[model samples]
Target: MNRCSFCNRSADDVDTLVAGAGVYICNDCVALSADIIKSKPAGPKRTTPVWEGVDDDALLAHLPRIDAIRHQVDDDLRSWVGEARRRGMSWDRIGEALGMRRQSAWERFS
Candidate 1:
């Protein structure tokens, strides 16, 4: 039986299960999500401004540090994906977990 993609509850556990976009959400989660959405503000959203203080030379000097961080992030992502696969999670579920498309996840990790 398939499990709720969000809560990992088995199909037998939830009162109802809804499936979409390669994922499932149980009834309880759905109701909670609806309530949360209802409680949100209706005002316009605000976005963070990009930093403009760093100059070209400063950016260039940080290239090595940026590259090291990128490598570390890649290693962590690979490790997480490996562990997820070992735990019997599907590519679709893994993609959902990582907030990416299933094909993107497979292309990056597989």
Candidate 2:
């Protein structure tokens, strides 16, 4: 499943997502962005650099969530490929969807 680039919310968590060349934004995020744009003053400024305040403890805490998302996405991909094959889709097309060669896709997912 795809996740919003800004909020990290998965596709399952949001109603819809606007996909772009290499990014996705969930509906909730899109609304938030629109609101932000309309109200222009912006949030308060921060003195710290991005992630500079993220200690090892916080990083370690987020690791499992990241891993879970990765595993879920991988499982979704495998199931989607299986379904596509069942529906008479070609390996070449599957490979194209994955941006890989047919042999590579087969070798990886078949």
Q: Could you give candidate 2's per-residue lDDT for residues 1-110 as a string of tens digits?
A: 67876667888989998775445778998899999789777678657875687999987877776676566567667878999999999999999999999999999898
| Tens-place lDDT digits, model 1, residues 8-99 | 66789999988654456799999989997898788887465433667788768767655554454566578789889999999999999889
Q: Quote the lDDT for 73 in model 2.
A: 63
RMSD of 1: 13.5
Q: What lDDT would each prediction earn against the true structure?
A: 0.76, 0.81
lDDT of 1 at 65: 55
TM-score of predicted structure 1: 0.48
Estimate the lDDT of model 1: 0.76
| RMSD to true structure for each model, in Å | 13.5, 6.0
Superposed model 1: Cα runs more than 4 Å off: 1-55
Model 2 global lDDT (CA atoms, 0 to 1) = 0.81
Positional deviation of 106 in candidate 2, in angstroms?
0.6
What's the true lDDT of residue 109 in model 1?
A: 100
